[model samples]
Target: MRLFPQSLRWRLSAVIAVVSVLVAVALSLLVRTEFSRMQLADARRVQDERIQLVVRDYGLSGDATLGAELDSTSIPAELRAAVKGGKRATYLERDATGAWIWAAAETNGKVLSLKTSYADRDRALDRLDEVLTIGSAGVLVLGSLLGIVLGSRLSRRLRKAASAARKVAEGDQETRVGATIGTRPRDETTELAQAVDAMAAALRARLIAEQRVTADIAHELRTPVTGLVTAAELLPPSRPAELVRDRVGVLRRLVEDILEVARLDTAAERADPVELELGEFVRRVASMNPDAEVRVTGEQQARTDPRRLERVLTNLLINAERHGAPPVEVEVDGLTVRVRDHGPGFPDELLREGPSRFRTASSDRGGGHGLGLTIASAQARVLDADLRLANAPDGGALVTLELPDRP
Candidate 1:
């Protein structure tokens, strides 16, 4: 067990408990000091009155023997000087026997002294200290206990809200933190939970509206784009005709990507897995492109949706050709495909935030619409596969695809 816990719950509880104990102990000490001071003040007042009476008697009778009433050794030198000058003096001091007293007097040649032992007052203070010690300990224990319990409860609610936030970030747009947070004495944390839920709901609605717009736009463009492609095909073979055909092809691919993304957004893809030799299958796809070098380490058999998987490889290879240098390396190792190219590696943003449709890397890639890798990622999701992009250590870009043994 950790002497100091690293968890937020324990840290907060410790802070509350420490503050509670310190404040209670400080207040208790202040009360005891004031109580003792008031008791001592009362004793000194009574002693002063008796000393005045003694001095008055000496002034009227003029008796020199009245000085003998007080012990000479107990009389402090500073008090004696004050009394000799006809000024009344009072002091609280411990004598040779280590006993406390309130001494008061006035003198005009013969000292009019009065002394009272504070042994009873000292005993009272000792008893008061014992009682205060017990009371302060109880307050510290009780206050600290209450602080820890409350801290634990509050921390748990905060944790629930944090977990829900993580799920939302990971693409579960429907995630929401419960308003109640399963705690007692409704507090600020419950309000925070409600706020988190509201934010998530708003985000889900906005995303849905965005996907609907994308799907509608892609659907609307299909007929006109098809007609344009047909008109360009009928034209005589020339530079202008080729340009129109290429531009139309880019637009057609972009539209298809948008439509696919809209479908994936609505969770509409279904997997139809068929057993195949993954290594041979990867070689067959790589052979379609003459520039790429396919290296088959060993055959890895798996059950996966071939059509979706083919789309993933097609998009990835096209991206490699457009952005990366020639002699592209494709390695198939037991259900894993590592595609590396000699070029400036992927942009930092592309690695951190996964592929965004129509967002290009910092490096130039001809004039790509940037939908190739985005579509590949979406298709990989449909196949329940992992698609990762990274910058290889040896001055190149790397894309790794890993498929499960069974879909």
Candidate 2:
């Protein structure tokens, strides 16, 4: 038979109960056996004492007439026969000359025979065995019942936890297994519940973030798409050159935005890193946009992918020109670069979102996708830099790019 139970709660309870029962049964059997042995010994001692008394009384009377005084009712017939039998007890009659003699003694004209007390002892032992058997049965029943009750309670608690976990798995973020104040769960179960709750919370947050990113992407893509459609419809060979240039510039900027987004996604795996000077680099990028006042503030150098870094700075300056009032300031510290635009700063809601693909704070702006800042932030990550967006207390948005001082 299998010794261990299958279920955890039953297994534990069975082990405890079985061990308890075995100890109790063993002790009971030992006590019962000892009692039975003592009883048998007492019976034998009484038999011996009576035999000696009867013999002494018969000898003093000079006759076998002491039989009438012997209480035969006190001893069973089997015991009397065994004590009187030649193999066990010797009976003798002596003449005046002390010569040995034998005489047949009868009780009421019946011959006495040797008796054995083994049968009585056997009966006593059988009674003891019966009592022990009944006690063991009771103990076993009681132990099993206790095991069942304890196991049932534990199983119920586990089932409740499992049910709550299932609800969480099925997308119920609020599902929780309430801590049992009456009987606290063990460490393993408590840890499992905690881990499940954490996972549910994380999953919910990720889903929400993804949904926001999707919405922002759609909003950003709409402006460029509408402009492209309008420009295509109004294409005219007779249009003024300035008008044509303006329309073409709009189309080129839109394409650049699209390409920059794609590059940010692939840069980490595709781009190669190179060494460059921060001071000269910022000056060169700023020169590209003369309309903006870009200044290098610190003398730190870095080893980075030049092409990607240039793209990042260029996009930032472009974003400033499109959204800010005037004189966009670019300052470089040891490993940090700060770009401040003199414009109405970032929207309060957009600051919490950090940055994501195609997300911009210019939904209210005339007609432009909010992709420039998003693209810049993604490129910063590919270069292993941190980009933070905050509003200047005075009045403007400050974009900080903190890079590592690389060799």
Candidate 3:
């Protein structure tokens, strides 16, 4: 059995219902007990008055005993014993017919009993029961409804904060929750939302400052890097000169990757969506990378930024060739593209932590600025696509890209 509701609204309503039930039961018992006590006191008073009347009658008639008049009354056994002993006694009890009987006897052998069927009292009790039953039902309905409304109101605020946090985590550093979830009444959840908004704002400022610094450094180094390349080309043909050129090229590529990452971080690259045959475009990208054997299957056409798609595919192919074995499979079915390589698959950190700039999936197997997959991922987001990395069960690395809104 499902013991609790996953939704907060139902849980709150359940709590209200339990409390209402307990309170209603307690109230009903207290009212019934008090009413019974009052009724019993009234019944005993009736019997006392009757006993007095019997004593008066016997004294006025000058009779020696009042047994004849007492025999017709419903005096209790205890009260009769007291009368025989020349003393007064009283008793209250219920009889076999469910009626309450109260009796009193006097010293002069006079006795009287009062029988109350408890009809009026019982009828009042029944009416009270009816009122309690109806009132309890009404309380339950209203309490649960109020709880649901309150829970929903609370849930909405939490959801708004949670949604904005997710957007921030997904690289939209500009997202903030404070505007929507204001700190009214200053509750704990409201305080938490304010904290989240502050954190997002701080992170956004830090990232913007970092990206600007990187872009500026890249721009500054371009002149020196170009000079080094010219000087290396002018050197005489030799092993050391070739090494100089090779190292310079690597430095140049690193600078370019850094600049590209900075641009992607700042949303500097805008997408130009165009209608293209996705299968053919991927096939062409595969042709550019001869290191991996590319196989294309299934045709699909979509409207998307072709240049960004090309960049994502090229990085995926390069990564597969550098870190994985041969036989890369590129398949496009509908709007989904799959790129698989025969290799040890993606590292655990890459799978769990996602792609990070300057953090290669495998340091020993490949060499780069470690921005290849990071760039691919950023471009995918820019194109409003999804790029996922995983290992094939058959022992290979798999990269899948999903595009939407087909033409």
Candidate 4:
């Protein structure tokens, strides 16, 4: 289905080969033209000299002999016409016999003509053509080979830069393309690599500044939020007092979520792996939440950080419960767990751009601070698990968590 190669290296090589072939053909034509002109000129010179010698011999002996023809009709028409006009002319002509270099001249009342075989010149041109064909082919092959080498080198450098960009996109801010450094001239590939590294450095600095600000704000608010919660606790056991306490509690939880997100963003928390039965773990975690429906399909065990895993699952459950309709289902199969809620599925933006902090799923679903899935994703990273968020085919938000098999 493809007419040409999809690789940069092959395209480059093809371009080079085409150009080389054109150049080779142009040069070959020029060389053949010049050589033919020179050979023809030489043949004319030899023919003129021989004609003069024949004329002299005829004048001295008064006899037409010795490779000379008297008014020969074998002479070319153009050359014969020139001789008839009382002038000498030389012409190259080819016939069944072979190529000939003809010279004719008028003397007194008679026309003298002489011709020599041009097979030598023809043979020389043939050899030259052969050489040119071989040389042009060699040029084409050499150009393609050189193009492939250069293209491969450039392709490799670009791939390195692309790989580094992928890593940076995947939340590895430290990943960089390590471009070549030397006195040699920097090419486009090197420039691209350098640009990737620069972009990553800038991004890392920006993210660090954002995380530091978030962490600082959370740290500053923790004390005031704690004091507010304590004051609300002392107020009284009335509706207004309970409302105050509830608001303070929400504030406290928000602050804690912010702090946790900050820590996860900076990768300050490391996983502590512990061998545990995955099915039992899912049942226990789901049991804590009365609304969730747990179904352990198979008994599977894994070596993973149970604490981090619990955090991720808890966020998913809570997010589903709060933002989705009732009948939240949790299924454990092998090393994977699936959590689904019967409600309008995740928002298009959330599914497209992954989870973002402070960006609620939707107004339709009871919205919160919107850090649940973000925290869950970060915790999944720490646990070295794969967390996928999707809208179930039937309906509702579906989240699949697959733990790494390191048993």
The candidate that wins on TM-score is 4
Candidate maximizing lDDT: 4
Off by over 4 Å in 1: 1-11, 45-73, 81-90, 104-109, 112-116, 130-143, 179-185, 236-243, 405-407
How many collisions between residues are there in candidate 4?
A: 0
Question: Which parts of model 2 are misplaced by more than 4 Å?
Answer: 1-245, 266-268, 356-367
Expressed as tens digits, the lDDT of each residue in 261-373 for candidate 2 is 65444333344677678878888898876766756667876878888788889988887778776778888876788888888878777688665554556553223467777
- Where in model 4 is the C-alpha error above 4 Å? 179-185
The estimated TM-scores of all candidates read 0.82, 0.43, 0.88, 0.95
lDDT of each: 0.79, 0.65, 0.78, 0.87
Collision pairs in model 2: 78-115, 78-116, 81-113, 81-114, 81-115, 82-114, 82-115
Error of 3 at 31 (Å): 1.8
Clash statistics: count for each candidate: 0, 7, 0, 0
| CA lDDT for candidate 4 | 0.87
Model 3 poorest ten-residue lDDT run: 64-73
Better of 3 and 4 by TM-score: 4
Estimate the Cα RMSD of every predicted model relative to the unseen true structure: 4.1, 16.7, 3.2, 1.8
TM-score of 3: 0.88
> What TM-score quantifies how close candidate 2 is to the native fold?
0.43
